[model samples]
Target: MSQAKDQEMSMPSSRQESDRTAAPSNTKSLTLNSTRSGVGTGNFGGYGMTNGAEKPSVLHMIMEALGLRNQAQNREPTSKDIGTLIMLGVMFLLFVISVTGFFVMWFTEYYNNTMLENLILAENSDTAKSWLNPDPKYDTLLKAHIFDYPNIDDYLAGRADKIKVVDIGPLTYQEHTVKDEVSFNKNFTVSFRDRKSYKFLPEKSSIGEDYVVRVPNVPLISAAGPVKRMKPLERLFVSPWIKQFQEPLFKELTVSEYLWGYEDKIIKLKSLGRGRRRFGLLMSRNGTSVDSVQLNTGEDDITKFSIITQFNGMPQLDYWEGDECNRIDGSEPSMFSPHLLQDRSTVNVFLQVLCRKVPLHFEKESSLQKSSEPVLLSEHGTVLAQRSDQRHQVLRGCAHFSLVPALLHWRSGAVQRL
Candidate 1:
């Protein structure tokens, strides 16, 4: 009986050993198949079975309930999610646009307010053209005529032999309207040696009509019409006589070189006679009156007085020809003279002659100079001409005179009519 019981237990042990050996073979086969079929190399729980490695979580339950509990899964965005994303992109674009518009408006306002002042307060705003009122007839044309016959010759001959004169001092400016144009005139007095005096009056002419520019606090309207008539001698004449001859027969004094000397002297003109000489005095025009200096001597001879007038004249012909100083720069040295007090602003007068210059060609330019460098020409008003006082004794002959252009031109032929 004991032998029969031992055989039964031994049979049960042999069956359990066979089962453990077969279980490993089946697990190996399943794992190989799962890898080929794109399944994860993890234990998938059977129906109502549990896995040792995995635990049941909320995400798994939710995915399982939604029928998406797969190792390889896909999810598409819903219409609601797409709409929300589009709304965010549109808001970002609108924010950029609003910022850009804000800066544009600020810049426009700043330009119109501040930049407008520069144009309105400018000293000169002469624009030669206007889009609003454009007329080809109003344009100035400088034409070169053939200078053939009676036309130009007659015009020059018949023109008045006079110069434009202005007397500048304490002036009274008057504004008036003339022929739909805004015009201005200044009135002043003229006295000859304090003997005879007359009130010199100028005719009103147009103003403020130079350009078509408009700015804040500035007048919009401008003058538009024919240029004012010129004086007889003021017109620039180029005769055929110039082309026929190699050069002009007689030398003419240009307006710029008209104010020549400090003392009284005659300057031969272009006329046929002894070519008149300018004596006494001449000076650059000061408005209507020629700039003159007066010395009031209290009955003492000016030759004996120590207070002499120091006058500076234009650069001389010798310096212009070729001088060492002239080679340094293109500027010529001015001449100075000290003489007894005279009634005229200039101490002497000079005659103009034709000149030629030989240019100096340098291989290389010198170093640039600063603008504050010293110049040869001195300042105009070094000393003023004042009446003598008790502190200083002066000659009685120191008299100041403001002569008419006619008196200077007729006596000395010193008038430059412009």
Candidate 2:
């Protein structure tokens, strides 16, 4: 036992002194060796000279470790070495192919994008054609329901018999809109004057032109507004004309005479810039454009597509005392940006006639049978008109005017943008 113990002690201490230094035989070992060599580039390198000896590349060293290469003079290769060489050659070819494939994919996408950008909004492009002549399928029918007072005699005489009122038949009209003097601006906007002429749809109407309903005297009430604001001398000078007008508090006429045009004694005196002396409810505002609109073309930003950037070269109007009420917001009724609908729940709209701007709150989501996408139904609740018993509400202390309630529907799916 003692002899065995002596032999173990004199065995050259295999734990420390007898331990042999190892040479790299794989990628991991080679990487570690290169890191310790201090001449390697980055974390795993073979780029610089160390101790006056050139270091081979990671690929070369790997081949040597695999017994497929010789650093010194070449020897007759074995079958195993030939197999390894073939494998290494295949790996190198695969690497080259991978790099080439990635580069080709990137280049193809870039080229396609460039082509798409150049083709956008060209004179012959689909976008320009659609803008010039909108699709008939997208046209929305505009119909109105006029509220009539059946017991105006009792209501005016302070008789509160529930203030009986009824809604008349649907008045159907076709909009023939024309956008003229279109100018493509350099600032990625298009300026154009918009006007809309109406075509009465007698066939679609439930009530004919001869149908009459008793309602408030629109012209007399309109004249009374100016009379209240006039000075005493101005009122006195206008008193004779007012007496000659002979327009009573209420007047009876057919639907055609009220809506189209009717001769009036006072119309000629008030129309300084008007072409016709006759007056109608809808005739004066039809196809009338006193301003231009600047719309974004979505050339640079897709979110601003078809949005009204400016109206009459101004972002807001001076017609109202409320800042929020006068500010112009939202896109055209036909077109809106797909990106904008992602996170928004409420939609804003610019109304030309009644209220300038209003919020359309979301009500519910529904799917149409013809469309694959779901749409959100929104509406402007009668928060203004419902507050008082008066038929008309003052516009931010500006003037007394009535508003027609309307609803808006928008699709949730990604709409194709220009």
For model 2, where is the 10-residue window of minimal lDDT? 406-415
Q: Write the per-residue lDDT of candidate 1 for residues 1-418, one digit (tens) a residue.
A: 8999999979989999999999999999998897655454444543232344546555455455555455344344456545655576699899999999999899987875453332221122221112112243332221111111112222235563432332222222231111111111121111111111122122321212121211111000100000114343432242232233333111223211222222212122223246433322123121122211111111233222211121111222233323421221121111112231122232222111112112222122234367544332222431222233421322222122221211122334423332
Candidate 2, 375: how far from true, in Å?
Answer: 5.5
Tell me how far the alpha carbon of residue 406 in candidate 1 is from the true structure, in angstroms, after superposition.
19
Candidate 2 Cα errors over 4 Å, as ranges = 1-124, 149-164, 272-274, 361-363, 368-375, 380-418
The Cα local distance difference test for each model comes to 0.29, 0.63
Deviation of model 1 at 200, angstroms: 31
lDDT tens per residue, model 2, 211-247:
7767556666667667868999999998787778677
Candidate 2 positional error at 131, Å: 2.8
| Model 1 TM-score relative to the real fold | 0.19
Instruction: Identify the leading candidate in terms of lDDT.
Output: 2
